[model samples]
Target: MDHLSTTHSCMEHLKSQNAKKSGIKKSGGKERPESSFVAFRAFLSSCDLFYIKHTCNFISRRVQKHSHLVHCHLDRTIGNNAWSDLFPRARSHYLIFEASDHRHIISTLDSKKKKSVRLFRYNRTLCDNLEITQLVKEIWNTSSACSVADKITRCRQAISTFSNEFYVNIRKLVQLKDSLDAALSASLPDDDSSLG
Candidate 1:
């Protein structure tokens, strides 16, 4: 009964508020004289107030969510025994989320090793280097392996070595760019830092 009465009273209050917002005030039961310009201005002002209120609410909600997320983390990672065997030294780590709405979770398979985990990739820039042909020819011709697969693997290894040796300066520049990007992210974040 109390709940029903409270809801009824709230509806009455809303109706009264709507009536007050109808622009022209009643005067002796005759339609009140209100200028079109004044009515339009009143409508615009109300709309502006509503827009500002909602916008402020949205921004505050986002800020509150971001601020409260510093200690609150609810992310999950599921794997099987096979996965565990493949990556015995796997670990989970959190990534900072400043510009994004959701925090990130990273899983590193080998977090302790300082060795390069970079996979072999054939860059378009490699074609421009004139020494690539000579290196390939030397690798293919000098390989003593009889089996085709063994020869291919030997050539791949040689090419990998050549790529590393040839792109040493490029590697240094990449390191420098990464450091600069890190410094920049300290002030403003991009997509996500937790991902590799």
Candidate 2:
């Protein structure tokens, strides 16, 4: 059993135990409120191959006649009909079982993992990469303070150029719309009685 299954088993047992306490009687007539998780774990130890499940329960309970929060680690392993169970969510961290000649390992995040994204051609009207790169190189490689001022001036000029280009395109679009409207009107049947 994996950590997930162990967690699920623990949750099921806990639910059953809770139901028993709340007068929501189970099918079995047994009135034991204590869980059988520990015993289940012990039975798992003597097996050659075993499965474990880890669970994290956040339920509060009354222990010793007082309300207290309890976290139970349920480790249940099944091997050769013998079992050993634990309750902690089987974190990826594992202990070295030198006697069994098995070393436990956990997964770790890679700091050097590279992130990449595809640049799509969403706006074909935008300047191409070569033009932008050349502009950047010219601005960066310029030595004189006057060249910096020139770079700013060029940027402003580019902005104005783009602004004029946008208006020109808008004007063309408006003209086309007007032409289309004129064509549509021309194609309509002229009737003096329809003028309401």
Candidate 3:
């Protein structure tokens, strides 16, 4: 049988065991607190399950004051295999409670694998810079490619290279300015106003 089916069977077996001990005649009736606790404890003893903390600070229960903490538990094997090649990293998301007072938990496997999003950056200030205009003109005029697509591609590559270099230079200049500002501030007199 599958893992879920096995878990279900084990839970059922625990419930039955609890029921027998409690002398409960009916199976479909509301479960008693003792029976529920026994079953839950038995299930915990049988499997290596532990609770996962929720992302939010708010309690899962309907009442804000009362803290009813329930955790999302996974098999010990699953947790162990997460670091290995067999399984990927996983995370649990606690959904908002609507119909039920308790919040529902959903485990998402391979949570570390993220979809790459490419952002195209445009520098509007480049239009005003004469150096950038001259560089673009040089790149466009120097391309030997006969086809319009190839020429456009070459120009794009040249522009991208220029933009990357420009940004790096700008970043260094900003860093230098920040350092100078910090030094100036440090060297200043502690008395409220030295200039006045």
Candidate 4:
């Protein structure tokens, strides 16, 4: 399974686990917590195709013993499966607590295998344009075998390319307007444009 389904499996397990602990009921009848999180241990049976590592990203103030407070692991790391496959020697280290009560979890990965990602912002106005609409539709139907993720990536690229061109034009227009205003001001003797 991919990251989404893997994460969904883990989260669904946690949600049900929490509900049971908090005395909350849900649909789908009663599910045993152990059976719900089969993905975690089941990976081992699948010839170690995936792995689940329990790591603490932060601390939740719960479970008080005597005069001291004990915190249980609230956040779990399910993606360690890929990490082991990429860098077997690397391990997660919990750094010292900083401004927040949560400690940072640092793990090393093969940087060469990772691709540089830039943030993409979606604007509602971009969707209103005919070009963008047509672009999205064309990309969505371009390949019958394209997965949903692939289609989304293509649409984003198209929208980003179109928006970038518009942005450049806007910048050029602003610069041209500024230059004209500067030239007009210089042509006049002073702040007065009486044309005497």
Candidate with the greatest lDDT versus the true structure:
4
C-alpha TM-score for every candidate: 0.35, 0.21, 0.32, 0.30
- Give me the runs in candidate 3 sitting further than 4 Å from their true place: 1-88, 91-119, 169-196
How does each model score on lDDT? 0.44, 0.36, 0.45, 0.48
- What lDDT tens digits, residue by residue, belong to model 1 across residues 71-150? 12223233334345566666655444434543345556666859877675677777777787677777777775557787
Comparing 1 and 4 on TM-score, the stronger one: 1
lDDT of 3 by residue, 69-170 (tens): 222211211222222233345555655544554445555655675788655465787789787788778867777555778776666666778788766877
Whole-model alpha-carbon lDDT for candidate 2:
0.36
Sorted by lDDT (best first), the order is 4, 3, 1, 2
Clashes of 3: 0
Tell me how far the alpha carbon of residue 9 in candidate 1 is from the true structure, in angstroms, after superposition. 44
Tell me each candidate's RMSD, in Å, in order: 20.2, 23.9, 16.0, 21.4
Clashes of each: 0, 27, 0, 0
For residues 36-74, write the lDDT of model 2, one tens digit per residue: 444533433422334333222212121122332222122
Please list all clashing residue pairs in model 4, or write none if there are none. Answer: none
Candidate 4, residues 1-196: lDDT per residue as tens digits? 4445444422212211332222122222233465554654554334323324334332321233454443433332334344455565444444444444334455444323456678888988776789889988888988669899888988898898888877687777666655543433231223343321
What is the lDDT for 96 in model 2? 26
Candidate 1 Cα outliers beyond 4 Å, as residue runs: 1-91, 96-103, 107-119, 177-196
The TM-score-based order of candidates, best leading, equals: 1, 3, 4, 2
